[model samples]
Target chain A: MNRFKKGHISVAVVCAVLGFMISLQFRISMEQKASLPYQRLEELSSRLLDVERERDKLQEKLSALEEAAEKGEANSLSDQKASEILRQRAGLVAMEGPGVIVLIDDSRLKSKAGDNQNLYIIHDDDLLRVVNELRAAGAEVISINGQRIIATSEIRCAGPTLSVNNVRSAPPYEIHAIGDAATLENALKMRGGVMETLAVWGIQLEIQASENVEVPAYKGTTQYQYAKPAGGGAS
Target chain B: MISAVCGLIIGLVLGAFCPLIIPVAYSKLFSVALLACLDSVFGGYRSVLEDKFDNTIFISGFFTNALLAAFLVYVGDHLSIDLYYVALLTFGFRIFQNLAIIRRYFLKKH
Candidate 1:
């Protein structure tokens, strides 16, 4: 009887261990499923889409309110005009007018006689120089490959590709600037200008003046965390 | 058999209530250990049916097999090779073989 009881106890202990392990494994797998990186990314993107939709709805409502206020009170007209000017300066409104489109592409031709192959590829610095020249020529709004050039926007190289406003853009960069087309084109194509520098490196450059050019509003939020109105009383 | 069932139920309840958390890095170790424990249990069951069950061997084998399997997984990870699959296959095969023996023993008796 004692031998039979001992054997049963041993079996019971082993079974307990097995049961514990199985339950632990199931729980750990459940935890891992909850913490997957792809799952988190999916959740965040859905939230971002919802936030973007809310922002668009708010913007439409603001426009409607502004239009109604403009018709109701003449005193509120100045306030609405001031807000419009601020939005335009902040790159919040899509602007369209006479401008210039500069198309820069990586050279397809192989290096000829003692030329470095690296120079044929368009670099971030080249794009920055072109943008600087445009801004210097009084270009009001600028965009590179559909990414609006806001004050906080960054353009840099990201391993074989270029990042404009943190968005990857390959060769054949289309830089559009909304302003005086004649001045912008002249600034880029002048002797010893951006065009000449690019041509020397075997980079392709095409500058065209357009009668009407649309520069999209900056899609990223422009929330200021530190900086406030000069007096700091909430203007 | 009734005692074993009761133990399993108690273990399951304990596991459910226990707040112990295993890191994601040691999940592979846990899996190999589980397989090793399962193989040991099956082996114990077969030995019991054959009237050759040794309590000391069963208890020692249960812990040692689980530890050795986890050690193998750790070493395999350090070597950047998947040796857990080999351990898994061997242990899995043994469990099935032991189960077959236990089934036949019961079948012949009844």
Candidate 2:
């Protein structure tokens, strides 16, 4: 009886600790499921989308006004050519040329237990780095998973997926660029370059050079809210 | 038994509100350790019912089993092995077995 009573004290202590751990794990998993920062990000992202839509409508109106000016004040042939070149440079027109198509996917290695599963997944920075390398290699126009890269476009993380110009896309990210195909492919495959770095994590990358790769036009708005023409009458 | 139940309830409430910041990496280890503790408690309870309880063994088993389970998980993480499942299965099976024995003992006594 005495031994049993003594054992109860030890049992009570162990039970207390067990209960504590159970509750603690429960709270932590719950907190992760509905974190405050994640909630805030979702709210802000929706608001950004709404504002982008508003900006798109304004852009259309501004383009209509520009068209009217072109018709009323007959512009010279050289001026029209220059404006067309500018539109192409601004990624407003779809571009097609000989370039490379890079297909990058998550690491093929089986994620170990208790290891950070995020390490095996593709990240926004990986896509950003690949885009930057392509640009440096003289890519004329680039599109990631059909979303064109623009001057004002943002490539960022939105939870498990990547948000490019406020549009979410998942992996196996396919990047298409229109430029000198050889140079683009060489840039990615350079020693210690983006491809090699990604290979460290077993991220699969396949670069295929094609004679005709289509880069779509930037569909997002480019309305400048604050900045105007520097000379005030350049147009 | 009553003190054990009351202590468990109080501990659960206290832990829930304690605001302890556990790292995301160690959450898995914590779960394995918790399972080990649970297994130890059930085993100890069974021994007490059998009238063969040993206080020293109970105390030591509780700590060692929890630590060993957590260690296995940690090693598994480093070695890229799923040894966590091994610890999980072992403790999970032990918990049920102990419960079954305790249930049989109660029935026999009655």
Candidate 3:
């Protein structure tokens, strides 16, 4: 009886019991607090995501419906503009699959080592041209550097590098565009295309035609608590 | 202009600072191994990954990041090596922040 009241073992037992009781109380409280807010947060986020997803899906559906209507309709600049505008409005993140890769290295700008100008470095303008022509040819998805190029995307030049949608990228720009291989190539090869423009500038342009193109996900955050659909809701 | 000179100075200063701050190579090997594991685990389809991520997600991320630190040091240029320390410190800071958050959320006492 005296020993039970005495050493480290007894102290440890008492401590453990106290700890367990405290933990039990804490756990119950956490569960209680977590329910209301956690459930609400989850529900709201799920709702927001569902709304965004439906918007994306419906945009594509609308465009397809419009195109079907235009199939036998009048031929005018207005029609062309409308279709192009529709494509831009229906922005979707491109995913990748089987695709051709064109490796263009400059023959005149010789260098086998670091900072060689001879290496086929795709510029913003070059990538922009390719993407534009591909979209015109009815390519579904396009990507570079794992960043999917949505319809509203912008490609620009920023001091010694290229920026697509304001993200910096460099060299042998792997252009993954998904669509009908033959149709896309035919469009790219047409006058004032990706290849033609580069060829005239003495910069080597390589053409690769593939049946499948695997695009990567865009690397960035998607958040804007504001700067949004402002104060309206059509979705 | 002054801005050009300032930029040049900053670049040179960073370059000078790199070698001093970079840790030895063994740490890098550890980091690379961790990254390889993460890569292998997340390399494919979604069905396997989603459920595992719901709880205890931070454990995997912490291990992955700790490993990356050593790696970035190994491959980093002079400027990057200096920045590596800042990354390390930032990492530690994040742990403290997370602990506080978890304590507040779970323990209900600050």
Worst-scoring 10-residue span by lDDT in model 2 chain B: B50-59
Candidates' chain B TM-scores in the order shown = 0.94, 0.93, 0.40
**Model 1 error, position B43 (Å):** 0.6
Worst 10-residue lDDT window, candidate 3 chain A: A10-19
Assess each model's interface with DockQ, reporting 2 decimals per model. Answer: 0.52, 0.48, 0.01
Off by over 4 Å in 1: A1-8, A34-56, A59-235
TM-score to native of every candidate shown = 0.51, 0.50, 0.36
Query: Which is the winner by TM-score between candidate 1 and candidate 3?
Result: 1
lDDT score at residue A205, model 2, on the 0-100 scale? 94
Report the number of the highest-TM-score candidate.
1
Query: Candidate 2, residues B12-39: lDDT per residue as tens digits?
Result: 9978998996898898899899899889
Tens digit per residue, CA lDDT, model 1, B24-93: 7998899999999989988987887888978889989999999999998899999998988999999999
lDDT of 2 by residue, A1-235 (tens): 9977776776777778878888998899899987988999999999999999999999998998788787875457558989899999899999998999999999999888998888778898888899999999999899999998888888888898889889999888999999999999999999999999989888999999999999899888888899988886685
Q: Compared with the real two-chain complex, what DockQ does model 3 have?
A: 0.01
Model 1 per-residue lDDT tens digits across residues A1-235:
9987987887788788888888888888888787788788999999999999999999999998888876886577777999999999888899899999999999877888897877889988999999999999999999999999988999999988889878998888999999999999999988999999889877888999999998898888788899877876665
Q: Which of the CAPRI classes, incorrect, acceptable, medium or high, describes model 1?
A: medium
TM-score of 2: 0.50
